[model samples]
Target: MTEIYYVEDDGDIGEAVKEYFESRTFKVTLYRTAEAAKESLRKQLPDLVLLDWNLPDEEGSLLCQWIRSRWKELPLMFLTVRNDTKDIVKGFQNGADDYVEKPFELEVLYSRICALLRRAGNPSGQKVISCGTLTINKEKMMVFCDGQEVSVSRLEYQLLLILMEHKGITVTRQSLLELIWDQNGNFVNDNTLTVAMRRLRQKLNQPSCIKTIRSFGYRMEDEI
Candidate 1:
């Protein structure tokens, strides 16, 4: 059965949702604290994560960002009482696949869960991608270069995948931020992108792998 890590602090709501998911044949694991959820995650990642907006220890959005940094393809959804547009945008910026306000109908929630799981199972639907002499499995979230496995932070991998998807074309900073950063069209500082690119180049360790465009954006350097 497909597994989901459901992170919510409220006992009543969590139990109700867990039962709802169970009735639909989904294997559900409940987590009440961010630390506990994160600790369990280190052992093995879940197929999808259902996060709440408010946690006893940390905000749900923060946990979502943490998860995105570690595994980009892992499906994430925010099921919380936070109904504001800002909260919704924050969830997206932090790598959430979808957001549903609390007090949602059980049927609607179930439908959303099914849709997310279905999408996760489809590899062809991925928005960002990467490929090279090195093996970069976007779906599996793994990277291999120079006959050795390379460890990549989630953000770096996300950025590399985005650039690789466009390959020869230039991708702008605004585009990268909108796509990669959990920010919703919010201006991202240059340092964040710079650091991610520098790390990506280091992980690939290819001097001319990524070329910076002067006025517009960046592109992968031509390979012979």
Candidate 2:
């Protein structure tokens, strides 16, 4: 599961955001002040951080700078009421991956958070997904298992990447069919998915990372 640190002084707003994100399966830690957030961050780093422009203890901009100074690659987003152009620019300058004004919709925030996480996972202009010993390099169009190249067909590779990208999450059969059908530009039937999965498992040497959920779909587990 992905973890998020949200720093906001407003209790109502903080709980609302935390509640909404938690319902989506994301573990969120809500901090009432910048000082409290800093204390918690020192112990455990989250996948992403959501900061408000104004805080009771310290300026959120300064805290953002503090976080970037340490975890330069960590994704940071600003969810605040500061909608001024200058404030927006300052947030970006302070190393925020995204900035969304207050009075926002949850759906938009969720999409932006997903986008930032995707970028954070695959950096340096290369698209890659890693689950345990298996690696899928989308940029170079290659797949490697246990440091050795694995030969996979186009449909097989596409199917593997989709599952790997959503690491630790179950990808339903219907969703897989739709994705592969559209991306591969070929009609994919239900049996095709089952056969491809079996072949993929064998080629990967029956890796335990990919789990078969009976009567549902498959989930890629990153923990080997």
Candidate 3:
């Protein structure tokens, strides 16, 4: 589920692109102004961005610079009517991974997007998984709750990743052990998993978005 933030002022173009992207299995978030996109970026970092020049609220180049400064690995592309050589050059200089002119073919745009993501080594981009106040950044393997970093052991982090990746689903105890310890070549007894889970809960501010299933496994949900 590759998440894309598309900032465009034109209603027609924005909706058309959103529909096309969704049909291709991409989760698209449309922003009519650069300010709106900026605000969303503060909370959720998408895998990529489709920007339009001459945005209603701000210059798209400024937005590109802003995103690049904060998230160097985030893929960015400009889809705009600004086809002049100067504009395209400026776009790349401002941190655009790719750029496409207006009246572009949707298929070609999609291809370019795929290429950008492939170059970044994210063929199947992941959505920024969030549960309640907790956020998981898979690329960095970092977790944050209430805007503060939640430090955890390697095994705990792996456990959190699996649960957050499958939010709302009960992942069984055996599966957790297999995936977290066995698969990682750090085999441990079942009791160790219980201890780690408890420490993780305490460290993440207790009742930290993880719920136990008594005889089953654990699930991540909005309610703690």
Please give each candidate's TM-score: 0.57, 0.55, 0.62
CA-lDDT, candidates in order: 0.76, 0.83, 0.83
Per-residue C-alpha lDDT of model 3 across residues 145-204, encoded as one tens digit per residue: 655678888888888889888877999999998888765898877899999899888888
Residue-pair clashes per candidate: 2, 0, 0
Cα deviation of 117, candidate 1, in Å: 1.6
List, residue by residue over 59-173, the lDDT tens digit for candidate 2. Answer: 8999998877755556899999999999999999998989999999998999999999998883312354566667665767887776568999898999898998787789999
**What stretches of model 1 exceed 4 Å from their correct place?**
122-224
Q: On residues 49-101, what C-alpha lDDT tens digit does candidate 1 reach at each position?
A: 89999999999999999877766667899999999999899999999999999
Error of 2 at 84 (Å): 0.9
Superposing all C-alpha atoms, what RMSD in Å does each candidate have to the true structure?
15.1, 10.9, 5.3
lDDT of 3 at 137: 66
